[model samples]
Target: MRLLIVEDEADLASALRTGLSHAGYAVDTAATGAEALAKFGVHAYDLVVLDLNLPDGDGLLLCRRIRSVSGVRILMLTARASLADRVRGLDHGADDYLVKPFALAELLARLRALLRRDGDTGEPVLRAGGLELDPASGEVSRGGVPITLTRKEFGVLRYLMSRPGRLIPAEELLEHVWDEFANPFTETVRVTVGTLRRKVSSPGGTPPIETVIGRGYRLVDR
Candidate 1:
């Protein structure tokens, strides 16, 4: 999944971007609320790590603006720890809140919790046909055999698995699986899907993924 970290602290933003990237998320950062909104307008993010104290605008207002536009998950990460602050943040549209000086592990757990609520099921392990994916463990397997995939491949499979048998356009995949740095017109999705197909296919077995000419790709529910 992709995330937007809106933090004015250079050190914190850098740390968050690095840490979240290592945790298998496409991450981007904005040091001000204006920059965050600009980036948000240009990219599709699964979640937002918003700080309440932005240089250009209040994070609560920004959160409201984002909430007004989309239902994307929001997690307010800030130094505000009072009960009123928490309630106000949630009232402003944050799905979750994490105080500063928090543990990355805890933040990840919270983020996963938010994503789980938005996903197809709350089982933690996603299953479709013979494929099994554990988002928490970052593991994918087929028919009891473990399958390793690149970050992009894993993200693509995760998305496809979420809505099995539904056609997904390349633009949708690029928007969600890749960060803002990806070129929208590039053939990256097709190439990544090609490589992913080879890795997940069983010996002498038909591939689980299906492609439609002039359309998009689908993960057969099978």
Candidate 2:
């Protein structure tokens, strides 16, 4: 998923961007509330890691602005640890809150929880045909056999499974699965999908992902 980190602290923001990117997420950073909003307006982020204090304006107001435009998940990150502060953050449309000096592992866990709650499907494990995907554990299996996938491959499959039986264009996959730094015209999506198809297909079984002429790829029902 994609994330926007709105933290003025250069070091912390850089660290978060690097860590989340390594953890298989497309992440972007903004130092000011204005910058954050500009990026938010352009990108459909799955989540926003917001700070209460900003160089341009209060983060709480920014949170309200973000809520006004989209229902994207918001995780408030600030040094304010008081109960009242947490409550206020939540009241300002933040879906989750995390205090400063928090462990990266804990932040990741909380992010996952928020995303799971946002998944309107209400199902933790996604199933299509003989393929099963557990988003929480990042696990996938086919016909009861384990299958290992690269991070991008997993992201692509997850996006496809999120809307089963629908034709997904290559541009859509590139927009959602890849970060802003990725080239829009790159053949990376095609290459990744090809590899994913081979890995998920069984020797004597029908392929689950099918390509359409000049359209895109679709995940077929088993």
Candidate 3:
């Protein structure tokens, strides 16, 4: 899943980004509300880890603004542990609330819970042909054989599976699977897709991924 961390503390933001990235999420960081909004405009994130104490504005206002535009899950983080603060944050449109100085494991657990709720719409496990991918567990299997994939490969496959049989351009995959820091001119998408194709393909069987001439890639359902 893709996530945006909106925190003013440089160390905290960096730590979250690094930790989440390692945990198989595409993550971006924004230190201010304006920056967060700008990134939100450009990317579709599955969740937002927002700090209620932003430097430029109230996190509640930002949360409202984000809620106005999308149904993306919001997990509000703050130093305030009062019931009133938590209630206020949820009333402002946060899906979940997390107090500051919490353990990373707890934060991950909260994120998984929110994502599970989101996936209650019967999309928790994405499937095409003999391939099966569980976003919540970060597990992929083809023909009952488990396959290991890099984070980017998993992101690409998940995005493709989300819109099965639809042709997705390389640019679109790059935009969604990679963050703003990726080099736009790089052929990373092609490379990643190639590797993913090899890894997910079952022995002596047709690959589920299709490449169209001059178009992008598509996930075919057998």
Candidate 4:
């Protein structure tokens, strides 16, 4: 596995490079955020170990920028142990966080966890026909235009997009979106879908989210 270590401290960076290399990963170290981004642009990395205190900018900013162009998993490392800092890092797009003065074993374990998560999971982006749903940004678009959708609307759309051309019952959608707390017989699913269709489909046209009478819905091929 190829990994990028974005850290400013030369000694710490070298130690990580040596440790990860010995652990059977191809390691690349960058001393600054700029260098990290430049390396990322050229070479695809399996995971990124980003230090929060960088010489150029905050690691959270770098994480967001990387997520904008690539879905690479990020593990944040920093001395800030406050709950707020950790929550902020995660909210910004970090998959995991490790506080400074951490053991090498824990770091390797976290790195392995990130890699395993990435490999086992299929593509996060849901694309059916011309419609696309990005779970990270909760953004949907058809062709190229942005399609604004509420949280529930995006959840319904994402679930449908996950299984294209398959009839998904309202029960399944409710369970998937609302964690089985929603009553499928209610008109909640239909109403949300109606709003979603209006936002995603072109005006005066058939929506991509097709309703199957007495069965469920399907995202049919155009």
Lowest lDDT block of 10, candidate 1? 115-124
Q: Find the candidate with the highest TM-score and give its number.
A: 1
| Per-residue lDDT over 1-222 for candidate 2, one digit per residue giving the tens place of the 0 to 100 score | 788999999999999998887676778889999999888988778899999999888999999999998999999999999999999999999999999999999998898888888772237889985689887678899978999999899888888887788899998888777887889877899999999999999998888999996899999976
Give the per-residue lDDT of model 1 (tens digit) for 1-222.
Answer: 889999999998999988887777888899998999899998888899999998888999999999999999999999999999999999999999999889999999999999988873346898985799998888999989999898889889988888888999988888888887888888999999999988988899889898887789899867
Tens digit per residue, CA lDDT, model 3, 68-151: 989999999899899999999999999999998999889988987787787521366878757899876789998678999988
Winner on lDDT (1 vs 3): 1
Superposed Cα deviation of residue 147, candidate 2 (Å): 1.8
Please list all clashing residue pairs in model 3, or write none if there are none. Answer: none
How does model 2 score by TM-score? 0.92
lDDT of 4: 0.78
Worst 10 residues of 3 by lDDT: 115-124
Decreasing TM-score order of the candidates: 1, 2, 3, 4
Candidate 4 shows a clash count of: 0
> Model 3: what TM-score?
0.89
Estimated TM-score per prediction?
Answer: 0.95, 0.92, 0.89, 0.54
Candidate 1: regions farther than 4 A off: 120-122
Q: Give the Cα lDDT of each candidate.
A: 0.89, 0.88, 0.88, 0.78
Better of 3 and 4 by lDDT: 3
lDDT of 3 at 212: 89
